[model samples]
Target: MNPTSPFDAERALSLARETLTIEADALLALRGQIDGAFVQAMQAMLDTRHRVIVMGMGKSGHVGRKIAATLASTGTPAFFVHPGEASHGDLGMVTPGDVVIAISNSGESDELNAILPPMRRLGITLVAMTGRPDSSLARHADFVLNTAVQKEACPLNLAPTASTIAQMAMGDALAVALLDARGFREHDFARSHPGGALGRKLLMHVRDLMRGGEQVPRVPADASFSATMREMTSKGLGATAVVDGDKVLGIFTDGDLRRMIETGADLRAMKAHQVMHPHPKLVRDDALAVEAADLMEQHRITSVLVVDAAGHLVGALNTNDLLRAKVI
Candidate 1:
């Protein structure tokens, strides 16, 4: 590497601040540029029977890919197609009943413009996203989304820094607008992103993380205190449910054992029901795991019994179970 002069920290910080200010101002200006054309474009996309096709060149293409992804994940079917590739044979992907959003800063890209006429002939709805309203792309478009910026954030005023931010903002605006129009909910978004954190919170149920069958610590209501303590110790849940058949009658925990010992109670003479706490906090089996976490947090308890609609003790879960499931 070649040697360079000493770096000026103040100058670097000043430039970073100026770059952010320029981009912030550009977005502020773009906010006022929202008009009927944006609404028309959104309506076209919403009414399309097929997918929304996004096309762009250079930096705008990167923004186009993100726009398509956001739209697809938020209930609108969309994808990105490179303009240069469309000129070869990718243009065949454009069919009738689709909405095309072509993005360009100057709105005069040769590769993008070359395929515009053919896309028009195919009778697809064309929406032009550009800074120049009078460019070739806008002329052929059915609707125009103006993403004009006062100047580039680059020191030379050449690179697409502020312009790219404006494009991204516009794309997000459209995706959110369509999301609202479709009445899309969190579950819908989770369905598309099943591998994400939101999916685990929304899709996973208490039964999925609860200890069922033999894993549950339980004993009969008529069992001796020692047997109940043995059941609790063997299951390692620090607690045991006192059940009458499948019905949950009460619960006994290590805390109860300590309290009974402190009170000088006759421990060897106590039955399971005599020592257990009745009406313990319970969670439904089909409840969301996050809901179980909420129940534990709200009650300030470490564990809860899982029951069915008929109030039968089906399983049990503790803070450790929720922690292992990453629901806490």
Candidate 2:
């Protein structure tokens, strides 16, 4: 924000390192605080049939939102409800069976405390995440997962730097523990993140994005170079497979075409098999698209032949298909 300030790499690096060391110490200290209260909180979250309603104020609220998202994506049903918003008609989001994770570094957020009595009356289980175990919020909570930090990374020791980092790390610990307890797998994670590249890599098979049937460029091994070029051009995939009945004899790519021309091979007299790569890269239709992409990268090829266990060409695909699917 200060345009007049000078930029110094060494000073910036020193400050950044100090900040990291402070936060890292805070996180390390959390390991010792993971006692019976932490286990009890995890159990309550796991046993909740409804959902985990996370509540916090200010910086704690920011950490709580990310915590809730981590829980939700990692197989726990969770959502963040701003403590300030909870009093203003957002209390309806909490139900009788739901579990509440109330977070406060001071354990005295007025808005969060304001809704606790009614929440208790509604018979909802309350778990507190606070730095002050003796504070009012802890006294009202059924279980308290203390997130106490020695001090903030801020030079003033007043900002929520180290404390917020500790809180987020604690939330991640809960998610990872619940993930293991619930038998969550990679496929389950992929299902939750279907729009992401990781999901595409984990879930998409070759058949899911391959060009099959007529869209595949194919020509007979005995076909002339002109016919092969026509097939490649029509498909616009930069490659074509030379087949003998259902079997793949060879492959001819645009690269192969260039080599043929450079060598001055008489195109009118040459056959498809004459200049084609005898052993073209092949992948199974059931193989993962990520595997296909790896194969292409390893072989330095633009396309691959998709076949079955019988070694019959069923389809084909180029890098563009993988790119469009976000698999590469």
Candidate 3:
């Protein structure tokens, strides 16, 4: 790579800053242009029984794809169909009751326009997102969202930069408004996204990875120290819940055993409740696994008790379980 001089580096940085400033101003202009048409477009999407089909050409098509994805992920059913492809055979993707969003910065893409007449004849609601309202696509649209920009970020003033940014921002705004209107909650979003780390954090409950039933290291309140140690060793969790039936009385970890030894206590005479930490940090079995992680981290402990709504010792979870579940 050729090393650049300080003057050249400064010029490059200045131009980059100029590009961002231009896009920022473009968004301000676009915000002022939001009128009754934006609301009508939003209402069309809300009222549609079928899905939303987004169409565009060139860079506008790229923006349209992201917009469609945003809408789909945020509780709105939407997809992008290339206008060029639509003209060939993908036109059937547009059906009655579906809303069509056609995007073109210039408001006139020949490929996009070629199929507009047929799409219009289908009686689908047509929404045009363009900078030029007088252009053919805008004129033919049932609703028009003006994405007018003063200029491009390109020094030559030719590339679709500011205009595209404005379109993307408007699309995001629409998606957020629709999301609010639908009362889409985080749990609803978690239901939609149930496969990644995000899904694990939002949907994975403590019971999902917790050791339950016989798997839980547990001993009766009257059990001997040796009995508690055996329970911990047998369960392989390095700890045991000192319980009375299903009700948790306290917790006895290896640390507690070490502390008892340090204190020179008569280990043979001590009961489970005598050496246990009372009212130990416990998590709900039904709570999100992420919440369990938070509790452990906050308390500086490696394991936690998972209890039921009635405060019964229902399960056990540790840092290792969290790692295996990919929730940490």
Candidate 4:
């Protein structure tokens, strides 16, 4: 009997590197091949009033879900349906006027092909993404977006690495194109991602998170330090707004009080206006909450006065408020 030599670690590492290199090159080649057919595919879906139904089988199904999510988040309404389940009644989820994006590496997944006739009969636009342009699904599609790769990243060229990456990239291209066509903006994206930190930063405004109305910790500029301290303490904001009539004159914070004490400034004789840093930084109620945070950091301050167009103090907010609102 012949004895087999032990596997070489270096050879194994070299093979892995070669696989990745080949797949990366394949994706670059795929990028150059994108043309008018891709545009037609995007236009077909854009023209439809109904949602985009993404369908695939096996590994393609996993990629399809991610593609559907990306499209939905970027202003194009889309959802994923497993091809295998479509035969068992999930096909009902698709409707006429909808766009169907069927994903298959070989373009001949039996499960996905089974639903084509019904989808066609319902007048749903079919766009196929496949490695083989001549495959059955592509031939039946209204438009075919080629996602072909010369080989897979697996040593035996069996795994779906290169194909899956190409499909994902193609999906991203479709989403961005549709987003541009629809005039989708940051606000639209924020509306879709309300639970994310980016969403909070973009969607939250000063008016939404600020302490307003009677809860505003404010004092007349002519008021004594003792009175201002009482208002700040009562409000639990660790700061008080100093105003002359409705105009914000300055702010007095816990830091200001500590500094005054260190300098032996007599609080009993001092008025709020005299001790306050006059003309302190202020933000408008309509400003993005993230901008307020930037302002606070820029001025080395913990709180900011929220004012109206005429410079009247309408609200107040602190770093703590931003933290609580998850805008930090």
In TM-score terms, which candidate is top? 1
Q: Model 4, range 1-328, lDDT digits (tens) per residue?
A: 3469888899999988997798799889898879899999899888888999999888899999999999999999999998888889988999999999999999999999988998899999999999999999998999999999989988777989999999999999999999999999998999999999879988889999999999899999889888988999999888888988889888899998899889986888889999888888999999999999999999899989899888888998999999999888
Runs in model 3 lying further than 4 Å from the true structure: 1-7, 196-198, 297-300, 309-312, 323-328
Q: Considering every candidate listed, which one attains the maximal lDDT? A: 1
What tens-digit string does per-residue lDDT give for candidate 3 at 1-328? 4566446778899999999999999999988999999899999999988999998899999999999999998899999999999988999999988899999999879999999889888989999999999999999999999999999999999999999999999899999999999998887787778987788899999989999889999889999988988999999998999888988889999888888889898999889999899999999999999999999999999989999999988899999999999999
Give the TM-score of each candidate: 0.95, 0.85, 0.90, 0.91
- Give the per-residue lDDT of model 2 (tens digit) for 58-142: 9999999999999999999999998787788899899998999999999998998999998998889999999999999999999
**Candidate rank order under TM-score:** 1, 4, 3, 2
**lDDT (CA) for every model shown?**
0.94, 0.92, 0.92, 0.92
Give lDDT for model 1.
0.94
Error (Å) of candidate 4 at residue 197 is 2.4
Question: Candidate 1 on 281-326: residue-level lDDT in tens?
Answer: 9999999999999998998889899999999999999999988877
RMSD of each: 1.7, 3.4, 2.8, 2.8
Candidate 1 ranges with C-alpha deviation above 4 Å? 1-3
> Which parts of model 4 have CA positions greater than 4 angstroms off?
1-8, 244-246, 309-312
Model 3 C-alpha lDDT versus the unseen true structure? 0.92
How many clashes show up per model? 0, 0, 0, 0
True-structure Cα RMSD, model 4: 2.8
**For candidate 4, what is the lDDT?**
0.92
